[model samples]
Target: MTRIVRRLRAVAALPLLVGACSASAVFADEAATTTSTTSTSAADDVAPSTLERDVHLFVIQKDGSVEEHDDSTLRANTTSGVDDIAQRYVWFNKDIEHVDLLKAETIDRDGVAHPVGSEAIRDVQEPRSAGAPTFEDGVLRTVIFPGVEPGARVHLVFRKTRTKPLQAGAFAYLVEPTRGPVELQQLIFDLPDDLPLYADARGYTALPPVTANGRTRYTFEYRHGTYAPIEAGAVGYATWGDRLMVSTVPDFATFAAQYRSAAADPTANDPTVTSLAQSLTAGLTEPADKARVLYDWMRFNIRYVALFLGETAAVPHKVVDILRNRYGDCKDHVALYGALLAAVGIRSEAALLNLGPFYTLPAVPGYGASAINHVIVWIPELHLFADTTAGGIAFGTLPTGVMDRPVLLDGDGTLARTPAVQPRGRTTRLQIDVDASGTGTFAYRVEDSGAPAELERNVFRRATHRQAQQIAADRLRQTGLHGTAHVSTSDVAATRGPFATTLQGTLEHFTWPDGTTALPALTSFAGGLATQVQAWLAEPERTQPWVCIGGDFDETAEIALPDTLRVTDLPTDTAVRDGFFDYASHYVFDPATHVLQITRRLTAQFGHQVCTPDQFAQMRGTLQRIERDALSQVVVKAGRM
Candidate 1:
């Protein structure tokens, strides 16, 4: 059974459920088929495992109890499949659900069945790292199949009974099948005929609802013969797969109202909270400034805990309690921050959203907390959203995880979209000096803003000294330079403003003093601007939309040569401009100082999160020109030019 709790649910795992063998699965359903088949040349190209049958059945009672049954069978085709699929895990919320495993067995290629013994099944609490605090109350059941090998099949049957729904008289479910080869897959639902059900069944072939025994049963079936085509750099599967969502709640507006009602007055009129909010904003007049002070206080003072146990999974703890503990999860941070903002006479609302790769929200509301999994604060007056849980992020700047995503604001009747991270200016400076022995010592620095800055600080803040050194060396090597590197940076733990990282290193055989050699392009130092586009150039033809971020990247290289050497030639300046992006590279030589200077810039203005094939094509052309110019050579002789 799949844990229906929003925070506990696994988006990718197929829930085990009751098997309905009466209806035959149709693999030729054109509407829901998103995969393509290619003729295999040999067994080596075959998929590791294929689902023989995947079935789910849910029975919803009027009193809000749910009975879920899942039965699935998978056949392993290779040794890798055996190793990966021989073990199965089922998770259930132990607080409100009980699970019973009815059958577990392995069927060999010879058609002999080997039933799993009780010793092979173990029920235990969800595994977490030592001393890591969690709020989850779910337990896991692990099943190990004995004598499982290639060409064998594993079968399991389980049932879960929920004593009561998390929300009274409200139920929701998201049904998404795996993008893998399947012989058959079925979804069956039995609900009271009087219950008003809202469902978004896009890409699924929904059969006519059958009303019998004062109940209506809804069925959706799908099957695919081949694995789905996974494009490189494509969006998440939930965005493009055959998905169906069913919920008793009508729309997002209703969900928001319910959430607001349940989470009202958590921080309202509290004397302690009011006092702290006043002191934090005592010297600040602007609301934004006061908000920033509160945000910074929360980030620096409150420790984040991932516990989502029971009702706290959706409702935040009392603001006073969270303040006393000096720690809370995302919701806790939002509540405490909201209380402080309220005390300062600034209004804010709790905004609910998913912080994962999924961007699109289905029409129907989700049940068991499956709809939205994360919460932040939205200040309408400032027209800015703040995720205090996101450490090292500047105020008014949202991280990429939730940027441009739909959000449901508490008490607000309509849904809203968060602003996207726009193209920001980033600069990379490289200072290089080459000796007569062909060795170059250099200092590389990259200054970044917005999401890039947050990412850089978070990475360095967590990296050990040895790991940081290895990272610097790896980054230099990626730019076609072989060297040893030591890294330097500003206070990485600081929470405000733009951040910079510097790498100082020595490059072996950096240049030939007597002949022509291309000026080394420190490609990696551009912070993925030059190197990333160069990689995209390899995929000239793309059928799916490419994930891309728009930004302006500039790199300047100041190269000082030995006193005995001088530059006689330089690469010609080149520029390419298109609708999607612009690229340019320039080189200059100084005769008196025996030095060379190179500057390369690439500006991508996608205006959106994804780039179409046509847009990528144009960008690719511009990048090719940039790459050529970056690889241009400079001539050096043993005398002045």
Candidate 2:
């Protein structure tokens, strides 16, 4: 009987489920594809808080003019909603509470005016981190599209307590019928002096978005003449949105200190929030302990499923709710992790990432704002980036897709890059000899652990049964023997986290094609059949280095030679080493019997050295030379001994 979860399968032409321990998976339907998206505002659902704040903001537009949206002019309370217009004098409330809002409005194509209302959705909160997400239970969100979209040239006017740039930790995407007639003219983001940004190379059109009047926007026409292909891993990031947007200020520590003091007020009894503030500088005694707790917590809880559909995918469920439910997307997983680290006195931040093979940050700068949707986190203090959303990997290591990309939302308000480490690798192989009747067999198995295995697994994990057979067939060719053969593989259950496959088969040339055959390794059909070498050397300090892994094999063959055959002389056993590669070969023969025994071991030591194609060619030449001396020829006498 086989046990496999039905839900654990690929979706949306992607490897949605990254096998958590329990084996639950995220599924995507290839049929339900989305083609376009609208950039909506964050102020549509939130009600203005009654708490008084001493914050004031000024919008420096292309044309120097000041617009005021203070509290007295509350937006017109009307049945027909009219909150965002170009010239309409309306009260606007930006969705964020960290900064006080003075005024907010939107412009249409004809420059029409309308009053803006508080339609922000505040309750849609997402906790950021690896373990349990610390969610602020109830919050509202935006009901309007405050920031300008690609179509109408839009500008935002607001103020904050600090003069330095304030990043929104946000991201946006523009999708339209590129396959149709419409051309994608441009995708742009307005940058504030306080916030810094970088774009993914693969996601954004290379021409670069147009910037004018202190704002940055990506502009490209989706015409066949100017078409830039967008692949699966495509996503963008910036400081103004959920992307790993980040920024820094000179007095941030002093500013942070003040916030901590204010948060400690008598009315603030929230345990999680208060604990986070208190632990910011004194949580864990050591770094490893902090890492383990966070790693284990995410693995044990916050189940991973890669649903991530439409705008709903962008909107995060409360971290607390995910904690209670014991489930979350990558964002939820990392959101909680970031919060927990903060709670435990570690410095951490959220990262917007692209975790796949087909996508990369668009080469032209600024399009990174469109190239990422998946989120993870980085522990700056520990200098380690961990992946808990998937399994069959060691902690502190990340897969290739997340490597060397920038992290949006870093504290610096600039495009901060995260350094990803490779996964732990392993490989194993075995060799043996079989008796005449094929009943008894002796074998030796070898295993390797490191980078090579990781690279091999990435491909093997994605192959089907047929592909698995080719791998098996390829091994047989290495023996310097050949014949027509059929290959087959064992049935595998999907519950396994790795893409693993096993195959077995035989060469069809069961007998000599002629009456007589020359045998290497023996004088009378059993001469030079053995090789010689010594035990391999190991580096005491350095680790194994391999880009592709999992090169292991076990080989065995038995023989009852030509009607009447007898063992004659067996070569003397020998071993040799040079502090690097090692080899040993042994052979034995019994005169009273027509039997012979042979065994060989070879191990090569390799580290961070320059290996060129020419070097590999030379190595192959050397192996052939050794084979010539070791298994050259075996004579066959017409009579039995």
Candidate 3:
């Protein structure tokens, strides 16, 4: 993760206008004087105009409260760019945190210090909200420095106090290194003698701790030239990068225990909840059917609203409140769904999941709240995971983010991994009837399951009939067809089994004109596959490992040509295989019926979601072959009418 330091301007009265207007001019004069005195060198030419020295200190009090102090010094390399620097901004949450400005000043090249005026400080609300209720939680404190220029340094120090811990006895802190080059960066943690603290560092080495003054201080330092700017398109850096994590609670078990204690009683009996569950499962005797009914009710009826203020970050709202309000966040959905399942004699547990790219849990033993960002319900008996917050997801399906990842179950503090779902195959079929005038009528059908099915349901649920028609037309256009398409599907709201879609359209210019003979250049049923391959080939190189969402694609197209046209040339068959991916295409022409049939299949086993550089090269080669095969066309000649 990258750290951003925001700057703002000051609008307060000042003692002299020179401190404001003449600062830039005076700094420019100083820069000329310094350049004349200093000898020119390669180091001087490449030197950065600004350098940051940052120190962050976290002090854990005896009662689990934390006091955080962040101090930084920004030095300018040249005197001319001083006024280009603006006021520093510090962010804090007003709901559970407070900020205090300790020091703000500017130091000139001559070692003269000027303290910032008190009237130069202003507090503003943060524009973005992470959890909900809009942008009401955060406050930004701005400190305006008057004498800023090249060779001038601005220093800012602020303290933030978390009055109450997210969980009563648990505490966790994360330190993400600043981006860009830095002169010095330090992270310090002060802990009481009796409090047990577990610290873990990733992507960097951790130094030893020093104890003094009846307190233990843990320090981690990064000297100049040690930081590297993150590369673009680097995947999974946020969850797997170099950073420090400290937690008071010891392990995942402890974290699960704490969560279970805070969650609603799964077995608690309520007439309203029981009645609703019974009504949903009135005639269903099978456990799976009953579970599906309850799951669907929660998913469709309840809206998702995240409220992670203080303890609510770990605990969930009451089931009664969630039922009455008809809306709740992930945890609330888990709680209510679990209760409903229990009422209907189906056993379910609350499972904590991390929705990021990190599938493997950290080996470090600690009860860190940052480990998991989502919660869902798990049916142990049925061996299924249900995420009610993901509205369109079917009963037994789990999103790729949570699949095959370790989940912390609430009840017995058990750690379990979700079952990995294999790629669900998608099959598309097209039948075309062409006339001698080069116009054709086509019928197309698509069938899909699992994640692909969920995606189709979501797309159709939000799209109007005209939008669907346009989408179909767009897909056809990729196949070199210019015409209108009408698409329809079975009720997307009906949740069960595989999803199916049907489309009918007219194709203009079904054959190309070349003197007397006509060239048949219709788009293949595997048009999307060819496009994807071309897009991948367009990239020079991939910085991150290629991530392929595992899936299978099978497309077949059958075209009936008019008697006036005879097949002259048919596309050649192709088969290519790479690591975890396979592609094959076949073409067959029947002389009796004058029909051309093409079949294409692509299987991608991207369950791991990553491919090494060597593997990617092989995959790209295979895709190129498939693209060539897809672009191959059948030619036709004029025959006796």
Best by TM-score: 1
Which 10-residue span in candidate 1 carries the lowest summed lDDT? 12-21
lDDT of 1 at 246: 66
Order of quality (lDDT): 1, 3, 2
User: What are the clashing pairs of model 3?
Assistant: 78-150, 78-151, 79-150, 82-148, 82-149, 82-150
Reference-based lDDT, each prediction: 0.70, 0.34, 0.64
lDDT of 1 by residue, 1-641 (tens): 37422111322111111112121112222212333222121234677777888787888876657888888888888898886568888877677778899999999999999999999999876653123344455577888998889999998889988775655565666666555466877778788888756666655667778889998888877665554465677555555455666666666787778667656654556899999889878888999899988888887788876433122235566788888878777777888888889899999998887775556666655532233667889999999999887776777787777776678887665788888555366788889889987799999888887667766877888899998888898888767778788998878877666788899989888876666555554434634566657666656565445567678888888888887676666678887888876788777777788667888888877776755555666667677776666666676766545
List model 3 lDDT by residue over 1-641, tens digit each: 01225221111000000000011211233233322332231342433334467777778765556677777787766554454345677755576668878888898878888999989989876544344442355567777888777778888887877776556666665444433345667767787756656655543345666677877776766543322332233334334334455566666687778777877554356788888888889999999999999888988898876432221345676787778878877888888988888888999888876665645444432322234667888898898889888877788887766776678887787788887555576778889988878788999888887676876877788798788888787777766667778888877887867888887989887764332444433334433455556655554444333335567778888998887777877778888886766888888888889888888888877555544445555666766677678677687876632
Off by over 4 Å in 2: 1-171, 174-219, 222-286, 307-316, 342-344, 358-360, 363-370, 404-409, 413-429, 438-641
Ranking by TM-score: 1, 3, 2
Report the C-alpha lDDT of model 2 over 1-641, residue by residue, as the tens digit: 00001100101100010100110101111101211111222334322111111111122222212221222111212212222212222121123222333444444446654334566313233223224333332122232435333233222233322121112222222222212111122222344433333322212234444456665433322221211223222221111111111111122232223222322222223365335334543456776676655665575556785533211223445555555577767666665665566566677655555564312332211111233445666777777776667643435556555655554543443455555333332222222222232221222222223433333443445577577556545644544444322333222222212232332333343223333335444221111122221001111111111111111111122233433444443456656544333545555544354445555544544331212223333344334433443564434333456
Better of 1 and 3 by TM-score: 1
